[model samples]
Target chain A: MVRWEPGAQERLAAAALELYASRGFEQTTAADVAQSVGLTERTFFRYFADKREVLFAGQDHFQQLFVANVAAAPPEASAMEAVSFALDAAAVFFPDERRPHSRLRQSIIDANPGLHERELLKLARLTEGMAAALRDRGVPEPQATLAAHTGVTVFGVAFRLWVGEHEERPLGAIEADVLRDLQALSPSVR
Target chain B: MVRWEPGAQERLAAAALELYASRGFEQTTAADVAQSVGLTERTFFRYFADKREVLFAGQDHFQQLFVANVAAAPPEASAMEAVSFALDAAAVFFPDERRPHSRLRQSIIDANPGLHERELLKLARLTEGMAAALRDRGVPEPQATLAAHTGVTVFGVAFRLWVGEHEERPLGAIEADVLRDLQALSPSVR
Candidate 1:
């Protein structure tokens, strides 16, 4: 339940992306982004550690949404379905208002090795968070971890599918495709 | 296959690990490693781009070996078992002479954030390589990728299992336990 000033953070991120697209990540500074966003440098620092952090602040929010969804998932849901429920919950958190900025953030992160590494670290953290959430709900060891990983892998594919084209699709659709992909891999199904 | 000066790379890795352990990675110079191994710094540079490169020089070699094993694996083997066969090949490749150095190498890579990130990148590359190899051998798209990832995930668990105090289990045994763990997570088994 970490509290964040989302408005300030979003403004800073938007400003940072503009600077990065025009200049570059290495050329842009937090002060420059803050100035562009009509905020003090201190305000920018309050939201993010540096320019790299701006691209990833949403990951923690997404992780929280994932855990909360998993915690409250229906008992009848399969392990993979529980994961889908979480992704659906996350889509609600990432509204249309944020998609353009998110796309820009992703682009910048993709171009930078340091940011890419942090993205991997964030994914690992989210997987661990999901595993912990599953464990709290009475799922056993290794399965809990493996299920969490399976969820991330599916999410990875679903996300790629979602972002592959500019048109938006419901998170549910993306998740369903991921489940289909997973089932298609099953020995009996294959 | 790319040719290597036989054991030259391994010798350099051993020398680098010893220096990194004693003097720390940041403090250790390439010249010091070469001096310890009674080789010229020129030879070391010819083998690796720089000092940091020494720690990761074997990653491509391991990936190639794993992919080749996957390609040669029995067609009838389950996806998990096919992955296990590749991992077993890796287990056999673990050098008896490099046990102490291997621990030190893992420690050095673990302690450094940059090194650890590169290691993850390497793992991601290997996962893709395995997927491509599987696909070439008639495995399909998502299944090929999933099988590769599942194998890599189990390898991670086995590596952790191998490192701790209760280290009597051979690598093969640890990998077997990992496979059992994965099957135990199956919907029917759970």
Candidate 2:
């Protein structure tokens, strides 16, 4: 029987990020990450489909958190308001203590085209999932799509700022700031 | 001497889209596209790096057009205004007559995971290019990124609506409508 490891995924991910930084992503293997954490290559595979998944595995939790929060929003909340509620939920997924790790992870992703594309693909899926949740709330057509996309975009821009080496603000606060910037850009906002 | 075939690219694309729909994107080959267009396989290679390029070769032109329009917007134009002006320019690339072609192309893309990822990557690059152009106009940080992303999202939502079989509106008009929807979602709009 295989021994179940608690926190195995987080351990493997942190080890993988360290290796991916010291060695290039292409140079690192699942075995390396596994051995770094005193586990076998099979254990790594148990948590992630591949090395790429180590960086992206959080996508599922993020999608679920956003959708759940959107669904849980007040029935009368505006589309953007529902999305804002979701962003606050998403902030818990990236607490203040993880900023350094987030920065490293982002730099690694920015250096690799394949990883970058995977990130964009994940973000697109998140937007679609969030929109579907909003539609379930009866937010119609392009409004659902636009608000979902804007929420994701605001989260993205804010996350980028929050992860900057010199920036110490919390992610949720940055999201609120970016949301206002989005509002200001629209000359016709009510 | 390879005689330059005027409109060879267009002829090949239409033929490829038809074949991709009829025979399926996977079952089709580059040589098949060339033969359907009455050109040599070598000619197809000259025009595209691979069969996939047949669908994406226009991305370069799309990027240039968007960047050019963004740069050309009046100095007083807001970030989204610059992007909206660019969207009008983009509309010319997808006129009323091309709706059927676009719908077919999208169905093909939606059916394939790899092609969909490539499409997302291209949209991401387009957003980055637009943001850079906005930065050149002295736009800063998250606002430029937010506006650029919003513009692309608006274009994407509007394009999907414009290509619907029941929808007969012009692409530019749908774009304007989607933009308004985006503005209205921002409850704090200026």
Candidate 3:
């Protein structure tokens, strides 16, 4: 049995990303990732099902943060307002320090059709999770799902902008900008 | 050599769906689907890449119809209006006749994680295609993407309602209702 070690998962993830960037996702193996971090393959399997899971490790955390924030929003908040609060709260999970890693991870995913599909699936799950949270908060059908999906769309747009090489603004600010732009899509709002 | 046959694709798709539903997706094969339709396995490959493609055959058609309709909308129409027009136009692709097939297909897809991921990817492609068409119409940044995604979301919700076991309303009407609900999601609109 492999002994438990502190920061092992993070170490593995960082090594996996580096190898994926240099060797390409398709050419990289689980053993290569484990070896890079000086860990056994068994330990790597204990942390991730495979190499792809290393890149997607944060998706569950993102969903949890988004759902918890939406569920905790004040009862008086509108669906959009609640979504906004949740998005802002979730932004804290993605700090500037992680932006470079995100960019590299995105490039790796973009190059691989399989990884891209998994990314889309992850985003879809996040939207569904947020929608369920909205329903729990008493939002009605269709509206809750729509608001949750729109919030996710805004988050996606904001994330792309926020991760740009020159982008210096906080993610919450970028999210606010994208949310305003989304709202402006409504003729009445314009 | 397999001769070109009229409705060969449709025949294969129908056979594939029925087989998938009755025998479970994983238990079925290309040979089984082709044989069920009295066609050779070679003919099946001429139509679909694999068994999974049978259930997703409509995705390309859906994307073409949506993009063409959005592009053909009146120049004076707002982005949202154009999206509404496109969605309405696309509804024609799913008449009452196809509802049973669609419902059956959805159940098979829902039971399989791999198929569900492919479905999400297909929807993402549809959204991207519509967004590109909107941009072609000079809909401007962010708004174009947002409107396209919202249109796809409305399509999804309307589709679920339209395919319900007891749903009797036409797909177009359900789409209009869902679009209205989505619009009302904006604080200014409500």
Candidate 4:
């Protein structure tokens, strides 16, 4: 049902990342990105609205994957549990070979204020999608919203750890540690 | 002691909000703000870095207030509990009279990408500050980070509820609901 072809978007994204990392995001041109993929500028436009869109081309698919996973979670799962399952589903989208490239994209986003805002908006949308999925699964209002917020916050922390070199743990291991961290944060204490 | 003079900051903030609401944030000049308060532009600058700073001016004080409260919590409280207590302290800072102004400020920030980016950075910093506070309170590495992240996410959800409601309830009630939502998130159900 998606209008954009997967390979075309992926090629454009990979090409954009190379151009952005090499020339800096501010210095990289649409023509440079198009030329890197041996595609015309008009063809690039067919995939993305502009240069910034190329950097975030796969976000829609990620949202779809997340929502679908949440929707398909076991019926007995709590709202938060369903969110955790959705996060695990999203992990398959990130591969080891692409980690460094994604890290570079995150770095460029961090450096650019406009991109950071867009990133925040993207995160907000993801949380909204998760909440909608939870609602569809019979979860109540505020709980659905809270679970979605918690899930995204967990993802944010996990991704930051993934990008940082802390004993070179695999991304899956780091994500598991993040989930454990959330579990260990109980209100009861000595 | 807090650094900024309270009354002066309050007047300038009120004037700026009024100008921003009526004339628009960009169209409203520093001179207009100063004139509204029957003060000089120099005095306005003394209170705020610029027109934009008027909207963000209280954030640092909020950080200080939150961290200090966390430090002051019972040493035996769990990391999340301590952070929750600190959030409660910060809740007192959100006076009933200020809700309208807070909503207006959010609208302005939402409409401007530059302001929204700064807002996200501020939220990130607050998360970091809460994490540091937890570490100081003897919480361990990753749990400290999770505690901070959860605290901020709870704050985020609570804020959205607080601002979205046209007829406002006490912030204490909203904070209680946010904490309950966090507690109701049972992980064992998955």
Which candidate number would show the highest TM-score if scored against the true structure? 2
Best prediction by DockQ: 2
Tens-place lDDT per residue, model 3, A73-114, is: 898999988988888786788887878888898889988999
* Candidate 1: tens digits of C-alpha lDDT, residues B71-168: 88888876655776898897887644445556778888878877876777777677778888878877776678778877887776676667645476
Q: How do the residues A54-138 of candidate 2 rate in per-residue lDDT, one tens digit apiece?
A: 9887767777887899999999988988988888887888999988888999988988988988888888888889899999999
Chain B TM-score, structure 2? 0.91
Cα misplacement distance, residue B105 of candidate 1 (Å) = 3.0
Candidate with the larger DockQ of 2 and 4: 2
* B46: Cα error in model 2, Å: 1.2
Quality of candidate 4 docking, DockQ? 0.38
Interface RMSD of structure candidate 1 (Å)? 5.4
* Global local distance difference test of model 2: 0.86
Q: Which residue pairs show backbone clashes in model 2?
A: A189-B189
Candidate 3 residue runs with Cα over 4 Å from true position: A187-190, B187-190
lDDT of 3 at B147: 88
Give the 10-residue window scoring lowest on summed lDDT in candidate 4 chain B: B181-190
Give the Å shift of residue A113 in candidate 2.
Answer: 1.7
* Per-residue lDDT of model 2, residues B1-190, tens digit only: 8889998888888888899989989999989998997998888888888888888877678778978999999999888778878888988988988788788888888888888888888888888898999999999988888888977897789888987879999988888888878777764421
Stretches of candidate 1 above 4 Å error?
A: A1-6, A18-32, A39-43, A67-88, A95-101, A111-114, A129-141, A166-168, A187-190, B1-8, B19-29, B40-43, B70-85, B95-101, B132-141, B187-190
What are the models' TM-scores? 0.75, 0.94, 0.92, 0.77
In model 2, what is the error at residue B99, expressed in angstroms? Answer: 2.2
**What's the i-RMS of each model?**
5.4, 3.6, 4.3, 3.6
If the candidates were sorted by their DockQ against the true structure, best first, what order would they fall in? Answer: 2, 3, 4, 1
